[model samples]
Target: MPRRPSGINDLDLAIYGHIAEGGELTLSEISRLSGRSKGVIFRHLRKLSALGVIEVREVGGVLLASPSRSPRRVIAMGIMRAAEYPYVLGILRGLRDIYGPVRVLVYEDAWREAQDLLSGRIQLAMVPALTALVANRLGGGRVQIIGGGSGGGMGVVRGTGGSGHAVVRTSNTELCAERLGLDGPRSYFGGPGDILGALVSGKVHEGVLWEPYLSMASASGLRVEQCEIEHCCLLSANSGVADQYGKISRIAAAAISSARSADLQAYAKLVDLPVQLVESSVRGYSFHEAPDVAYLERMLDAARRALLPGSSVRDAVVA
Candidate 1:
């Protein structure tokens, strides 16, 4: 069995797994599979279904249960406008359960998040891991990664007519494209929307982006090769906030770190994309409570070759 996340118990997880494996089962079937009494199973089923953590269907006068969607509560939490991160929805849902009423702050891009973090306009922000790294450096190392978010949501697309030209936005993505040997005069955009729009307009041969932009590009008949990139996004806290609100930071970290793929898939509808696209995009992403040093090292090496001025990944990482 997978390790139990905070708040949920081992039995809840077992029941979830059983229902998931069985596709859809009645209370009695789940009880038998779980080796629990029908009444006990029925109670848990009702609770889970009501929470939207599982789907309950009525057919032939019998209730069918399946681990379908996870529960998401509307609550206040602060977040950026970068909707490409699949785990962002999951984390917000999780954080809402903890903090109540997540208040979202939409910035033009991750760079804006970094600026807000430095100016005390935001207490907590989730941006690209590289963005957080650079922000920490810019802020004299006053920000720290309290947890990780989705990674590998970015991709490089070849233009419609198979041109070698390309465009980029994020630093990490630019590095990934360079590492992939996509040689061409690169046009730079400040945001993913511009890059995608340019790609659609035949202005650029290749565009680097994160999903659902990448998925959108592919759906529009453009070829999207998933960047073999990792650690794309991370949750960072201002050092002062982390120091004074450590418990809240931990809660937020635990919530995000515990996000499962099913949570990401369920969130697809919220983002108005096909579940398969969200599913496909996230297969390349990994969520964790801590940064992957190896992946960061690889990314940093690539960043350096692409003319990024970071001395070392370690210099940007929080202890």
Candidate 2:
């Protein structure tokens, strides 16, 4: 039996993009512009209209579609391993409480978030502080740090025999390994989400991952060789949205300053881990509103050593 379509598809996205690029488009116009058959286009348009992502109107017996205004204004918040970091999760929860159901874009690397931030694809991003610096340099210093979250959560773990065959997650971890002399074993690079699985599956004998993952792995019987590094994650915004700083800062403060133990149980559920593990993970990080210049420079130096191209750390930080 042919299954009924349930939600948005590429056809729907293309049609919406076409309409969003200009004035309202008729069904035929959307089909022609998007290069899809009329019947397929109609199905997608009907779905999008039903979902309220696009508007459908009739004029002169022709059905016309237009992009909804709300989606365009939606600020895209980018993150990785959101459930692991309390402050990152707090910022997200806080923003949604203020703005209501904002869109989130998940990426494996801060590098990708930096690219999207520069291209205006994401209005706000929660990235590694250095990644924000790299993007700031890329944007000619247009990136602004409204605040920061999740301090001191980085660490490295090794498998049996203490061989550091590792896949480090962030550039920060890479730097930590180099600084602390944990870089001896052959190392590969993976995103935070993949690091734990990689280690458990024996793809790598050692792994460097951040909170919740660190706790979860230890709970699952993997030995944690070391977890003592303390790097922060930053809340970054495009300079164009600087006027909204007052609101952003307020939301950040409310979330980070008011963090309570009860919050861990809820966050643990998101990552499908034990409340105890989540509680322990929270101890790995410090939540705060601002970061010092020297600390940011250390991160930038690491980013530079890790060879993140373009813009020295000095040029990247906003005054």
| lDDT (0 to 1) per candidate | 0.64, 0.64
* Model 2 misplacement above 4 A: 1-66, 69-72, 82-84, 87-101, 161-170, 184-186, 265-277, 298-303, 308-319
Instruction: Name the top TM-score candidate.
Output: 2
Whole-model lDDT, model 2? 0.64
Worst 10 residues of 2 by lDDT: 1-10
CA RMSD of each candidate after superposition:
13.5, 9.3
- Model 1 TM: 0.61
Tens digits of per-residue lDDT for model 1 on 148-175? Answer: 6666667887667535444444456666
- Model 1 scores worst on lDDT over the 10 consecutive residues at 73-82
